[model samples]
Target: MSVLETFQLAIKNILSSKMRTFLTMLGIIIGVCAVIVIVGLGNGMQGYIEDSFADMGTDSLTVMIMGRGSSRSVSEEDMYELVEENSEYLKQISPTVTMMGSVKIGSDTLTATSITGISEDYFSMKGYEVVQGRGLQYMDMTDRKKVCVVGQYLNMAYFGGNAVGQTLKINGNTFTIVGVMAQEGSELEEGGTDDCVFVPYSTAARLSYTGTISSYAITVQNTDQISEAKAVVEQKLYQVFSDDDAYTVTSMAELVEEMNSMVNMIIYILAGIAAISLVVGGIGIMNIMLVSVTERTREIGIRKALGAKESAIMRQFVIEAATTSSLGGVLGILLGYGLSALATSVIANVMPDTPITVSPSLLAVVVAFGVSTGIGVVFGYLPAKKAANLNPIDALRYD
Candidate 1:
């Protein structure tokens, strides 16, 4: 018989035994569903992390002085000079000083709020928008103005979101709220940006009782120039701090790349774990195919006695096995997508802001289906060979 004829006969036989066919397909369906769910969740988590980092601004670098191995550390003036020298690479720079303080409005008090002391350039450098009033100016830092910028959360929680002109008591010192920042969500593990209170770095130094400000944030002219900017900044810091261990300079781009690599590694591991099911499914196909050959022994004897070649019998069985596996793969793909959607929906409810999305590639689906079919061919061979090698005279006489 021709190849098409053999496939048609295989299909007829498979359909004739519907229950057996369904049982054989069950393994592939489960295997494919597991793989899809795992991969889809991985992609979604990576995307959420990337988005959070993107919000922090990709063209920015953060410098922190550890002061572990050197007596002297990078100073605010040193940071300013570095920005001035690398004017072509850097767009803006901000010195950061931070402290924990209580913010109070009338009788209500919110404790342990982050009090960030930064330069006039901080808002722009950090990609924050001033939703109300005006941001701090150079004079604010130079004159040590007793003015502060409240975050959206603080403003809403204490001042009904209209604290732009209201006076807030920070650590028992009164300061005018000159600006209210736009609402910003949380950082990776740290608290939300909307909970912070901004002030001039000089004022923050007095509040925190520290003259030495060790952290600096700088915005590069372009993301492509982050490497050059980082090198220049590190060189400047090295000049100030003799020991390299005393200071560390990092870029958001570097953090993003590392995070993405980690996410990819996790996805690969999860996919590997899920692939175990496919192997099990292939073994199930082999077992069922073996049973099929035994049951059809009498039919095989008749065919051989009627002059059917061994190759024809083998091709028929192989086709039947491959068809079964491919059909299972197709059904698995559909079911996998459905399950992925449901999983994403549940994740979205838990974290509406960081919605989990299924972004499986076309190649992934194709590869999954192809692998299942290939498994069918590999496992089906032994059963097909047994059927082909049957003795016609003995098979016909069997009960």
Candidate 2:
């Protein structure tokens, strides 16, 4: 028979037993669906991680100095000089001093508000715009000014969005709010990114009673040269302390890459586990095809008695199995996409802050279909061969 005629006969046979055909395809359907969903979940998680790291700036590096047993201390001036010396690789540096205290705004004392002291250049580095009033100036850091910038959450919640020109006490020292940062997160919430305060690092140093600044945030001149800039900074700091343990330089890009690697490993492991179902499905297909061959023994005998070639008979069976498996795969992919969308919506509703969006890639869809169809071809071969090799004269005599 021609290929088309054989294919049509296979389809007719499958349709004649619809329930059995569907049952045969069940395993493949579930397997493909699971694989697609798992892969899509991984993709969503990866996207969320990248976005989180992007906000932190992959081009930035953070340095923490432990002062080398109190004998060797790297001063802020030393850090600035290092940046100035390597202007080609390094862009700008900001000294950071975290202040732990309650903010007393009028009669209310807000303890959940985070307070940090940074340079005037920090705002520009972080790309934070001052929506109200003005940001910290060069003089603020030089003269150790007590002025501060407040996040949108504190501004709107406490100051009713007119936080600028207001006064709030931190560490028992009153600070004038010179500016209000434009909202950081999508929406301002308590104890979120928008609930924070920033002051001059010089003032923070004195207020915290720390003689030496231990932490600095630096941005690289070019994003592509982050590793080179990090190397230079680490080398200089290593020279200053003469010990690796005394100072640590971390690149945000490197951290992001590491995080992505960890996430990918986890995804791959999960996907592998899910792929076990596909193997199970393939085995099930083989068993069903074997049964099909046994049930069609007389028909096989009649065909062999006629002008049908063994290869043609085998090819027909293989095509039937492949078509069945491919159909199952298409159904699974559709179901997977539906589930992915539902999962994303559920996550969004349940935990709105989470940035994950489950989306199955086209590559994943194509691969799932290919694997399913390939499984059909592999599993169908034995049954097809058995049917093709059946004795036509013995089949007629048995009846």
Candidate 3:
């Protein structure tokens, strides 16, 4: 028979045993769908993290003093000397002193306030934009200004739209509000930016009574020179602090690379699990084809008696098995897309700031997964050949 005729016969046979065809294809459908959905979720998560990093500013680097052989604190003078010495690569450096304290204004008091001491560079590095008043300028740091910037939540809670020139007391010390930062989505992790408060580094140091800073946020002018800058900063810091292991430097690029590696590892693990399903589906196809061969034994003998070639009989059966798997694969693709969409919706609802993105590459992979299901015929071949080679005389004599 012609190839077209064989395909037609195969389709008719599958249609005749619709339930069996569907049952055989079920494994492939489920397997492909699972792979697509899981991989898509991993892709979405990676996109979300990248967005978060972008929102937090990409050119920023954070330097913290670890202990020298279990020491906890590093002196401010040491941090200053390091920055002053390597003033080429580093554009701006801010000494950070964090104190979780209550801020009171009139009768309203916000208790969950993160009070930080920072410099003018902090505004640009952290992607903060002033909505009202001005940011802490060069003059503010030089004069040890008591001016501060309040986050959106704090402004609404304490000042109630009257925050531009207001005075709020942090840990019993009063700081005049010079600026109110714009709402920064996920970047403002602890609620609105207005909820947190920023004071000059000098002012914060005096208020916290810790002459040493907790950490320094450093910004690099040339991102490509991050490695060299880090090396320079480390050497300078080691010289001034007298302890080579007193500080640690962390770059955003390194952090992003680590995150990507973790994401890739997870994707690989999930893909491995999904592969098991494909194997199970292939086995199901093999089993079903075996059963088909047994049932059609007499019919195959009659076809052989009619002078039908062994290759023709083999091709017909193999095509049928492949068709079954391909159908399953197509169904799986549809189901996978549905599953991905549902997951994206749930995640978006939960995290309005982080969006899930599904790329064309993911869709292409799903399509390739479906195409690979055609390998089911390879497993189904032995049974098909056994049927095709049956003896016509015996088949006719059998009841």
Q: Which candidate is the best by TM-score?
A: 2
Candidate 1: residue 374 Cα off by (Å): 0.9
RMSD of each: 2.7, 1.3, 3.4
Model 3 agreement with the true structure over 136-202: per-residue lDDT tens digits: 8878877888899988776665667669888988877788999998876545444454468888887
Ranking by lDDT: 2, 1, 3
Better of 2 and 3 by lDDT: 2
TM-score for candidate 2? 0.97
Off by over 4 Å in 2: none
Work out the TM-score per prediction. 0.92, 0.97, 0.86
lDDT of 2 by residue, 1-399 (tens): 898998898889889889988888888888889888888998899889888988887889999988667678888999999999999999999999998888888888888899999998999888889999999998999999999999999999988889888999997899999999999899888788999999999999999999989999999999999999999999998887888998889998898889888988987788778777777777877888888888888888888888788998899889888888888888889989999999999999998989689988888899999999999899889888887888888765644
**What residue runs in model 3 are displaced by over 4 Å at the alpha carbon?**
67-90, 186-191, 222-232, 238-244, 350-374, 395-399
Q: Between which residue pairs do clashes occur in model 2?
A: none
Give the number of the best model, judged by lDDT.
Answer: 2
Per-candidate Cα lDDT values, in order, are: 0.84, 0.89, 0.77
Task: Name the better of 1 and 3 by lDDT.
Answer: 1
Q: Candidate 2 lDDT (Cα, whole model)?
A: 0.89
